[model samples]
Target: MNMATNTPLTDEQSTEAAIQRAGKTAPRVTLMDIEAVVTSEFYFTASDGVFGASNYRPISDRSGVALGLLTFCVLVLRNGFTVTGESACASPENFDAQIGCDIARKNAREKVWALEGYLLKQRLHVVE
Candidate 1:
């Protein structure tokens, strides 16, 4: 019995309805696809000495004691939305700026996935 109409639904009717629902286009996202959507990007850190391919930023005290390294990546999507990610290294010996930036950008990109997923779900709901 159909809950809404309280009518007896045959097996064929149920299968046909399920097949029809399955036919609706499903949305998907991939990391590579997300990456391509980024139009402009930049980075930030406490120190600029390692802003090269490694993208490392070092944080130190007034006494110039090496503390840690931090990397930040900001991604701006084609839609004008912005996302941010950060990477941190507690040991100065592990100074790798590029890795930090990559990590931060990845964190930021994760947010984009959530946002895009919600929008897609909303659109699908309307279609239903």
Candidate 2:
């Protein structure tokens, strides 16, 4: 996890520290931290689309798309109004599944942003 050196809200850090002390395990990973990594990578790669060479295969009704790689399976849903992402992996011993889901959702949201821009221009008759 490429986490930032600066801590987040004091309350979050306190809670995480408490959880770690109680469990005697590695520092807990928060969803916010995971999203930060995903967003960072999204811009780091200059938005060449998320998940390199990963393609989206539409499911029935074209409401969702599935991406399968190695031991991971990610599902992204875009229904013209909302977007959602979820992932599952063969191994339950790690955080790959959750990270995959986060990346997938970020990828779908970028696509939606592009669509929104296009629609805006269409409505306003703005040239590209």
Q: Please give the RMSD to the true structure for each candidate, in Å.
A: 13.9, 16.2
The residue ranges of model 2 lying beyond 4 angstroms of the native Cα positions read 1-95, 126-128
Residue ranges of candidate 1 with Cα displaced over 4 Å: 1-25, 48-68
- Scored by lDDT, the top model is 1
lDDT of 1: 0.70
Measure candidate 1: CA RMSD.
13.9
Q: After superposition, how far is residue 122 of candidate 2 from its true place, in Å?
A: 0.6
- Report the lDDT tens digits of candidate 2 across residue range 1-128: 21576545455457666776788663334535333333222211211233445543333332222223222222222332443333334443453544765565555555544555566567667543
Candidate 1, 1-128: lDDT as tens digits: 79999999755457556766788444655455676789999987645534353565443553222323666778899899888877777776776878878778778877887877787788889999
Q: Report the error of model 2 at residue 71, Å.
A: 9.1
Clashes of each: 7, 0
The RMSD (Cα, Å) of candidate 2 is 16.2
In the predicted model 2, the residue pairs found to clash are none
